[model samples]
Target chain A: MTRDSTPGSLRVLVAKVGLDGHDRGVKVVARLLRDAGIEVIYTGLFQTPETVAAAAVDEDVDVVGLSMLSGAHMTLAPLVVKAIRDRGSDIPVVLGGIVPSQDVEELAAGGIAAVLGPGAPADQVVEVVRKVAASRS
Target chain B: MIPRHNGGVNSPRQQWQKAFDESRLREGPFQTLSGIPLEPVYGPDDGEYPGQYPYARGPYASMYRSKLWTMRMFAGFGTAIDTNRRFKEIIKAGGDGLSTAFDMPTLLGLDSDDPMALGEVGRCGVAIDTLADMRDLFADIDLGRITTSMTINSPAAVMLAMFVAQAETAGVPRANLGGTLQNDILKEYQAQKEFVFPPRQSMRLVRDTVAFTAAEMPRWHSISISGYHIREAGSTAAEELAFTLANGFAYVELARQAGLPVDSFAPRLSFFFNAHIDFFEEIAKYRAARRIWARWLKDRYGATSERSMQLRFHTQTAGVSLTAQQPEVNIVRTAIEALAGVLGGTQSLHTNSMDEALALPTEKAARIALRTQQVIAYETNVAHVADPLGGSHFVEALTDEMERRAEEIFAKIDEMGRGSILEGCITGIEENWFQGRIADSAYELEQNFNRGERIVVGVNRFLEGNDDDDLAILKITNEDEAKQKQRLSKVRSDRNDAAVRDALDRLAKDAVDSEVNLMPALIDASLAYVTVGEMMNTMAGVFGRHVEVPTI
Candidate 1:
């Protein structure tokens, strides 16, 4: 839990929203972010949007990264973003998983800051997290 | 200067060492995923013959030459009607067997209309809330003719009860119903995380199901001991083999403690494995799994029948290997993995779709995935020979090493539970031992890929433009959810509420008594049109919900 000297040393909440149990990608991303000197609060599997929004605000994370492999991303992602906004927090939301490219615009329209699909390397993810957290700061 | 390595007449080991030294191959070590060093050649004693008592070459003597493996394409998404259409389409597309994939809600023992199931209804796979949904899922397919494999855990008995009740209504004899239920719950706590109850209570439920199925459905597989999800969760092939077979042994021990003979139920046990991109390693895993299971079943459990000792399995091409960047390349990956499965002598196979990394496969992608297997069976001529690479030095050595590594893992697990695989797995799950190992392995794999030690064609090395948009991903909309909800609501309104309540009460009572099997009550509840949530909640009253202790 040591804080790095970097200004953009982001504190992010990585969560698995809804009943989708696939967490290998989410766990990997969390490790990569931690390795990149970021603080990550991972709400384990089978969390709801309400719990996620509350955790994001309570943990005071700079960003929320929602990872879903079950195609329920379309349904789960928006609810998470709306829940965050409903909590009166403008913290940026970044989405990752087996998201098809065609749905990127729709997810963006729902207030997602960025969409990272499978094979997005750890460096690229760290870059995205840094940029998103910097914007919030 | 090179010591005439190529032209050497020395012993194979000395010649190999000379070439190894001369070539300066010491720059880096070459090892398998399980950390076994690669050897130059293997001797005759490296492995045993196929169909022997402790079969290492394969489970069967004849293998695919006698009959080709069953192409059981795992397909299900949307409502039962939607999946029924897909089922008919697959059967028409040369698929011999059907593997059902239930939606997340169904997997977790929730009705489609539950609040927890709001956005997930009919999304990942088909949603079955009541007996009607099961009836609709098997609409055109004959239960007596086509062998169906249902991939569901936690709520497996509820689904099995529904399938049985549906069969009764459809006039199919109970003895004629044949298929596999992915009732392996230990792995859920270990890797998959789709569990509903705690380990001890969950084992009791699984025991009831196994005991009931063994007594009633002679043709049905009580459980498909699975390593596929373990591999997908990022374990090495050796870990997958060790953990899965260890779970199988736990189930056997549980059944034996319940007074069921090992032979009566062991023959009905099947296995499921993942066919990853590591070609030779994957083949060796299957070979090792058979040998290990055979020896443990015969020597440890005291099983006399050869049928009880044989380890038959179903293989699915690794979904974790598919990349979203160049989705089309997944076709090649799947073909290679599927070939490995065939060469490994899988009893049945499932080929993952090309677009899986992006979304649930589109119709075309699913067809192409099935065709991948068809081509291997028809054109490659790989199936004509049994254990085709059985005698290869690399494969035999790898197979032996795989068995040895798995045995080490088993011993460690045994130590954790005071020399009991069943108790050890439960403790392992509670302590997060299995999850920790899987997380470490997954992290290592990703780190290797990121550091350039491992190369995934589209993901790491091949710098291709983003072709992701070209894929036509299957999208389940809000209407689909609404439609499924409406259907569930109608069933709720139409069914006899009092009958449902009574049946559920009886189920809860049966679930409480450890000696009493809950199958009969489950069947009654299913026939009463009680939803999955209703039945699971009834049992949950007796056995509380499982809360996982975080290992992260």
Candidate 2:
């Protein structure tokens, strides 16, 4: 997808990808990215992987950010990555929330561009997304 | 000036002030996180005694002197059997009460084998699809002898029905079984988002449970109006107090509207709060909460009984405050928060495990968390005094400030509903008023931490030599989900389909009328082995599912 908005500005899609209703983290991240000059689209709670992938493709965003706090990150994140890939798109996905350190390597090797755990600082989150978006672009 | 002396020697206050003026103080805002200003030292203040009306000092005259707060650790994972083993361990390890955590699928009223329940069954808590699971959950445990608190809402009525049926089958009379049901559905919309039906329909369900429990089970606490999720969702301490008490009032109105006497059901209502990391502010919040609840129950709701006016609550150390980085430091954080809960006079408490920020607490972590509470209760000598911080000038001032701010919020909500707290809560949930305020507070706190104005020990300021890679966390494998599916399938196949259909039909028909109490029908359904999903679906078919008006 070509740059649809400002030439250098990145568009990131943040979402809550499971039955977990804890959206405080995702909503805060959306604001942080927005304040950092990134155009962001947030898919609210109870979103399935298929729905999130379809939204990412439909919005034509530079990156997809999935927030899974319900310990379903291991199972749901991979499905989301595969769903995005099967949709004929290679939008890099960044995973965040209460993911254990042991699962970080597996998630990265399973097509996730970045994995941010709980207490990840705003700068780290923003820089990770920018780096991934730049690499994909 | 002839050796001016306020007293025989220099007065203690004057001497302290002289020393304080000479000592160089650090640059500071010198206020609580909730923005209440604090004084370096407190003076005498005339405060009410413990066990009085309004109960500002403490709810009971003796407080912990009479009995220590129950160390109710919230335990659940994998399946009912897995959680049952944990419950047995807790009871053996000096725990007096059991608190159950349901998995995401069970919490949302979905069967384990449902497509929507994929990857979620038995992950966060125990998965209960039928009364069989409930019975297995308490297999060797005696229901009449021990009390269990189930942290399940939205589908709480069904869970209660299953519990009642399980107890009766085990030869325990319904009246003898004691426990608490977290039937506070209003907060689900405002913060937790685990709701199934719309606001009005959910209130009807809550009303039904209140009426049912009041008439039958005298030992059961009908609704535990909660603010823990609200605070965890990122509200200020005052918002948690205001919103939770407002919700308590709404439940009272619902019960009164159902033609039940205020004293009959009001005494059974309880509360749950979050004891956050702010030491003095959390204590002040708890104090203010009791005062507000007692006064509102007596003056606003017109309750004559003291039991009806008393605001008894369970406190859980804040889960959101734990950090994944430097996980061990969370023990210290939990200790401080638990102390605040104790000093604030909570009836029961749950401390967060050190590794909770990363995953569901492992066995060792949960045991240490329980030990933290034990040390406070046994070693600290904090329990010897009731409302230990009662007369401190700073604490008294903060308590007043919390009450003032909460009353302002209540006034706004009252205006929104034109007087009824129940209607006000419905309006607040509908318009996303509560959601927006909570989100704003969460954003501000994040921004503060991001800018280095706030110092989180591991995350922001002290970022050296912290390694969590070696920390062994609990991993819920997919095997549990597969096994849970098999159990659910077997139950579905073995149960009489005709009987299940009949029970569900009766529940659906009874649920259509607002005046009808659905608990009896729910108990009948549980006896017939109708699954949670079947009962919820039957009711949802009548009430329809609630989709939130998204607020970002």
Candidate 3:
């Protein structure tokens, strides 16, 4: 309830899609956004794109951040983005993990609003999320 | 105690002392990165010495002098044929053993051709759908001579069945087949979320595999109780040690409850740990693990054999510690972590390649990672002596602290289950207790790094220009995925469909009875050329799937 007090708190849904179990980055980002006075909902590991997109609509979050370390991003990112689109929510989806540099353009083309690779600072991530959420709003 | 002074013009220590008086160090007392306090110097009375019942010193009397730790780089990617060629190359490069990293599909018990496995077939690791792939995986390599370690958990039993079937077809007796299965399903719930079945049912499969290996595959390590993934998932060293040992204890209890003698199967049990960047902390954690495991096995479990009390573990340099910013610095980070593992007495070590933070290791990077171990083994004198830092007051104190914290954690976990480890772990997992703790630690660390209180060299502290263009990363193409699909299709068509169906039916029938150990049926299915996915699907029908309780 306290999260609603801050103006433009930018409710964000952090989702882990596919069988990739690496959630350290996503959990860290969730805490970071929550600390920055943003409303955060974390969908725990092993989530399907359908489930993630449905949760985004049901929760009506302003933004969605998807984290995956397994190279299933190409296959999974599109599904989640399309699912959110099909649900008629223009929520910006941010991606993070150990993504290769070459895959950046392709992932961005697949509707990833921002791509944060490994070692991206928390402040930079927050700034990107805030900027994207503002644009969406 | 007074500082020692040498009667020279000026000793290096004396110069530093004078400079400290003239200038200043940090504002106050110095501590380890993990917040362990540091005294100016160390002497006796820190803790017990290495060797003996609680083996803080080392597992064996002659640690590396008798035999150096096996250099087993975790390598697998693309199709089985591709990985098999890499295996031969590694053997030719003088690797002592093999460590297999299966692809996401194979790891999660999905066929290569499954719709869920699109674009993930040969990306992370090698794709092995059936016995035919396993046959190609170890094609030219002699199974009797080279011991292999597989990093698979949920479907470990099926993979082991396939391995056994492959070896049998190759005329290698089960007695001669030696390898380790990372069959640590508990950690799957705790940290690495690659699990399929529910917790209690997953325990059944783990128990069945451990029981079967204790009897039939005596030479094989039934399960490698892994703390590596736990630490990588952002647990502190103490949590990693305590949680891993608790899981180990639970497995031991489960096996004993299944009517197996402790000593008979305990010796075959092994451990796997992560060598994080905290050099002294990692060393102390390993030492404390050995001592705690030895004492627990002896006193708690009433183990008389020394072999049963010894804790043998494989170590891998922490991939989480690697940086994508200045990838070259990862080489130094991995070497330091590898050194810590060696000093801490790992039975085998896998140093991560520098490029792993970006992509799967390129051949040159993997080779350099292997050479890092060779340099440590031959050039460095650290291996000549066992527990070389055994008597250091700092190390001993840290080791004692680690053991103390682990005991506290054990007490909490025990309390959770009403003194039953198996029950407590199940409750702890279901309650998201472990996940909560790890998330807290990870969040704290991230906050520290973000605030510049904790510094990662290339990432936060030292700024460097862009120069990663020359770094060649290994890429798996759509062709690789298509080839793997074709291979799986061929295996499906080549095998006798009726025989495979019958074997799977028998497996499904046997799986319902708690009294039946499922390994024999699994092996039968494997021999009948039942795919890994088919075997797991039959069991999943009985066991059901695992859905995690959200923590954050």
Candidate 4:
């Protein structure tokens, strides 16, 4: 977490990192976090992992969430994490959208702080982000 | 058994009232779950019949009795050969039509070897780069006999050209090919977002395809103007109807501007819609779509042929409506949605598999999804009548309401384009008006679900005893990517580099001249073994790429 970021005042960057343009879920989640009094920086569709990581560090957000519905999570999620690490930032990364159950464990072990599926409620989504953000702090 | 009523003792109305007063009904609150009030009986409102002008009842007189809707299942994943096996399986299992789903890379005009396509190739759908892959995609399938619908855009020209080239190599004349190309690009900027060149340049490609198909392929549907993506992107039912028809009108105007006759191409211009939940709403949307298209084609576009006015469409059970929790319940959801599509007078239907929310469907799940449509066609008597809900007061009123709302949207779009729908669509895409509206709808619906105003079974409510772990999901291995890259490399090595370069150069040259239809050049390029990426790159050099300004 950034030194300037306070406890109650958290920030999150939500992005769609890949060729998938299924933004219905990601856009809704962005608004959900915004309505929960958290600052949300949505780096819109077709973002590369490096760009997303760069934006996260430039914004100095508390957490980053990637929405992958194209079934490329197992391959892309780790790349995003590696990109963030390469940038010397250990910000917590959250994964959402259509992740199969068997891959959830692997993603969690691969430094994905959380994996929210399609049926995740708004409060649960908000709480998960908050918890991940708070853990980093 | 032979009891007869007294002819003069009692009036018929009095006898009905006596029976209604004495008969016991089911428990109270006889209404739809959505709170729409239901009447015990409904009398006919309008005397409109099927196969008429402004077809609100149905498109054809004998809807299902004459010919049942084609059960078209969408199948694609991994390499072209993998999808070919599935295609054969579908045909052998009695599927009448084939709907192909292209991978994201192919959809975006990228080859499997492109860095942007890493980890994404063959994950969502099949990967096709050149004519060789296209040949493998339809191996053993008779292109002349069976109709194929390719769910592709942006690079639709390349894919369609590849199809035509493959058919030609198979000794099938281009005129004998029967299929549909989902070459609708306006919706890409608005919803699906898999776009390449700028809107005007992309329109030129679409125009070229429309002209080519109308002249060469008589039985082919040039474009399946789509609302499935609009609704999937979270637009309301009326928004989907209005936007889809508006895009359809835009295409019509584009073809007309290109000097094509309205009756020549309008008959083959089809529609694809999403059959979401809310059964009556979906049915009414379909009815209103047909009515609006008919009136617009006749009154607005000045079409003389009835075929141009008749609005025929294909329906797919909403993929967005599938739930990951209690995944098996999706079968029931699909069945109801498929029923709605049939009752809405759809010409064809595709039932979504239960495991879509988690992953692409496994073979067993895909079979069950197909069976869902079969059950609707064979077992249910719903197919026995044409628009069986036509005369019901509730449905009729809903249909009218949908039409009114859609017209209001159309008027707004017209105002945006200064009385031209095509210009209005271009302006709307530039302004992100449609994207914003759909995003707002999606957000509102999510709020409703979060607040429990909407009940998604096993998601927000009925959360007990649900275990999705036992459900098996199909996985696409990374080896498909390796194999596809190898095949692409082999094609590049085997083909004459000079011929490929010349063909692509011709395509680029023709793309610059608006008067020239680029289809012949594209077919030449495909025949020369120029890849989709290579051809699109050459055109992009002339037309430039379209980079969208993000909405959210």
Interface CA RMSD, all predictions = 2.8, 3.8, 3.2, 3.7
RMSD of 4: 7.9
Q: How do the predictions measure up, each by TM-score?
A: 0.92, 0.92, 0.91, 0.93
Backbone clashes, each candidate: 0, 0, 1, 0
Q: Show where candidate 3 strays beyond 4 Å.
A: A1-8, B1-51, B466-469
Chain B TM-scores of the candidates: 0.91, 0.92, 0.91, 0.92
> Model 2 chain B, poorest ten-residue lDDT window?
B39-48
Query: In candidate 4, which residue pairs get closer than 3 Å at backbone N, Cα or C atoms, i.e. clash?
Result: none
DockQ of each: 0.47, 0.46, 0.47, 0.49
Instruction: Give the CAPRI rating of model 1.
Output: acceptable
lDDT of 2: 0.89
Model 3 lDDT per residue over A41-98, tens place: 8888777888899998988888899998988887788889999999888988988998
Winner of 1 and 4 under lDDT: 4
TM-score attained by model 2:
0.92
Evaluate model 4: give its TM-score: 0.93
Colliding residue pairs in candidate 2: none
lDDT string for model 3 (B174-244, tens) is: 87889999999999989998899999888888888888888788789999999999999999999999999
What does DockQ come to for candidate 1? 0.47
RMSD to the hidden true structure, all candidates: 9.2, 8.7, 9.2, 7.9
lDDT of 2 by residue, B347-397 (tens): 999999999998999999999999999999877666766687988889999
Task: Report the alpha-carbon TM-score of model 3 versus the true structure.
Answer: 0.91
